[model samples]
Target: MDITSQKSAEEASGRYCGILAHPTSFPSPYGIGDLGKGAFDFIDFLKKSGQSLWQLLPTGPTGFGNSPYQLFSAFAGQPLLISPDRLRESDLLKKDDFLDIPYFPRDSVDYGAVIKFKTKLLRKAFSNFQKMNNADLCAEYDVFCEKHSFWLEDYTLFMAAKEAHNGIEWLSWEDSLALLSPSGKAAWKAKLASETDYHAFVQFIFYKQWFELKEYANSNGIRIIGDIPIFAALDSADVWACRELFNLDSKGFPVSVAGVPPDYFSTTGQLWGNPLYDWDFHRNDCYSWWISRVRHQLELYDFVRIDHFRGFEAYWSIPFGSTTAENGHWVKGPGKELFLALEKELGRNLPIIAEDLGVITPEVDDLRDSFHFPGMKVLQFAFTDGRDNTLMPHYFKSNCVCYTGTHDNDTTLGWYGGLDTRTQDWVRRYMNTGGSLINWAFIRTALGSVAKYAIIPLQDVLSLGSESRMNTPGTRDGNWVWRYYQKDLSAELASHMKQLTELYGRHPETSVWHEQSGFATLNSRGPQS
Candidate 1:
């Protein structure tokens, strides 16, 4: 859709809802989820349940801790998310290759095992692609490489060198390579030419499968909402390729790191070790890096949610060696100057959502409103203070996106159960519920809000507890591993969701929900054969 049509639709269809699920959480037999049958099936489930949007975490390749926020490349799609089944369909693999599938737990991802297994499989596919010498396929790969050369060249080389260095962080490499000297880059490129090509081939398959899946969702009237973290990983190709744009020491260590002051998620505040951006340099350069980043994300999703919107106004900067955020202080950011540059380059009124959740100030609100980007209102934060809180439904403006709970929060059932008795009673009285189905109560409240869009975590729809939580801020391990089974998306469940959606006037195509005529029986293809 063009920018004009998108604005028109936003004005017309003011109420919509969707589910927040990362692709890795989808059920699959080959360990973690990929852009395979499971993804398509989930899309089918969304359509059946009357959801028009599919919100996902950042789809970039993950580094340590398996957190999507710490990405290997700001521009490249996750190679691990590529579908081996699709590769087989493309004659890149044989049926025998599937015979050796390893056992994977149904409820959580085993990232180490999955990475090892999938990497081998991807390598096999890449070798087959090279041996086949298909002219048309090779030509398509060339076009993809050339089209994305601006970022892809650096990313593939980064990965190839990482492999050569036994997956060590760039700073630990020889000084010349660690600093990304031109001579070092040229020498490594010559030595690892084949390895670089292999990485490029993997990316080609990843983008191909991803766009195909995205096309199917759009064809079925489900627009995807993707995520973009406010900062890039310190060990990422973005920082390594453009070191001068970040606050780095001469030895390539972060001079200061990104984090937040004490907030709801943590007592000590979350110490996110990403290298802080050099905003003065960015402003001097007209934020060319940010412009390309936003433009690339816009090409990937219908709307991109910028995590940590307040950071653009003022950011919390902690010393690089600090373990906690206690010593951090707020530093002024580029503010409107950055957004104005983005708008000038990518066109006015970009389709973006502001995650205005943490330590917000009036200046931040003004910056967000000036661009007309909708900030978020999470229902999980509503009842703690009272009805008058900005997070409460009654206080929400029509421009915001409401959520029962975000990925960082506990599932609604889990959160409600853990509340103090008095707070729980307050919630029960506020929602006029007996608390039997607190999850559904929160969902109903979010959908009924004045916010233009309402999003629910899939775990809440299933009424799962903290065991299915996606992430816990400030903690290092055992996050981003939640998964649900295929049977979880039953036809009965879809009908119920559709009924609630229509009741809230959020369903676009259906004005009435028929109990007698329930949703169609599920014929979704199960886990990979």
Candidate 2:
């Protein structure tokens, strides 16, 4: 509410309970879920559950690995997520296109097979278009290309270059393609014109389908919360196309990468190989790049959660070749200057959530508080240490967003099942509840907390165990593939949750929760997709 000065008091009110499920995890016959019926049905499910928000992982085009955080382009949607069913409806594809459909795993996404099949399907769709060019759709495609030319042109060219070079990393491409020289760029543009236009057409399809689904969700009163990773992957177009904005060498290799120093997760620490930003260059441009990025996310989601929010105050910079984050040093970030620039570019009221987890300090807290962005609280991290138990519900403030567990952590039941006797006892003593019905117990405890927004992962809501857990940090393979059946969303489950939400005065439709007025009273406030 502090960020947006435009909305009325009535508009700024409501305590919300939401579910976290990435669109890729949606149940579908396709190898991966897409922006099609599955997404719409999930919206229907959200409305049925009385959930106001649908939280998702970043939907940007994935590269290197299938990790959503490591994206090819910050602005482009994943073409793999484009539904063949939706394409059929649009007449871009036919039943024959799916003649060789691989039997994908119903319980998990097979990213490899999905990619091959979807790529072939998309190319076939493009080929079919050559035979039948629908005038109206073509006109819309032209307008979309014109409007998004700034990002689309570079993205399409980048994708074509990737294809031409047999999908090698940008840095390894030929000098002309890597540096984008004047004559070289012109020659490639002419030669790869067809390939580039194909990529752009795919983006147009992604944009059209995604916005249509978003509109459906909005119409049903379900708001979306999207994520923004703090740093871009070194291999991403965001860094490659704008090499000057990152701390990169002449060959586009990062001088310093981004990661945290040693802590709870590992003694060596998690060394994320994303390129560190050139804050001085960004500052010189008045943070225009960041403003544009924020603007794009704001348009996509009702609320944007900035992952690794502490990075804005101070980031951990690791030497590019380091194997461990222990060798990293903390470097100062752009801080409030960046967000103030965002506020000016956007509006007074910015809908942002700060993923204020990990090694945090008072400076980070101050930065988050200054923006009035809600910091996150996870229940699984609460009982890990006695003195460090700031995550306990009793310590929670109403302005924060609380979760039973996040994607990085195990599901609630999974976490409980893995806990030792002492920790389990501590959890019991704290909640005044035994091991029985632990998942629902945590759900109830989260809803009943002072926090204004309580969001539980879909796995916790369904009482699933480790097998259903979405992602485990520090792993490369066998992650980001969990899927839920349509039948998993039972009426009984929805009723149970709605009862708890209403009982705790946490139903978003009723009133907004706030710290100053307390949960019983009323105030207003405001992540990641």
lDDT of 1 by residue, 162-256 (tens): 99999989988888788877887899889899999998998899989999999999999899899999999988998888999899999889999
Model 1 earns a TM-score of: 0.95
Identify the runs in model 1 with alpha carbons over 4 angstroms from their true place: 1-12, 511-529
Per-candidate TM vs. native?
0.95, 0.94
Model 2 — which ten-residue stretch has the worst lDDT? 520-529
Model 2 misplacement above 4 A: 1-11, 511-529
Best of the candidates, lDDT: 1
User: Over the full model, what C-alpha lDDT does candidate 2 score relative to the true structure?
Assistant: 0.84
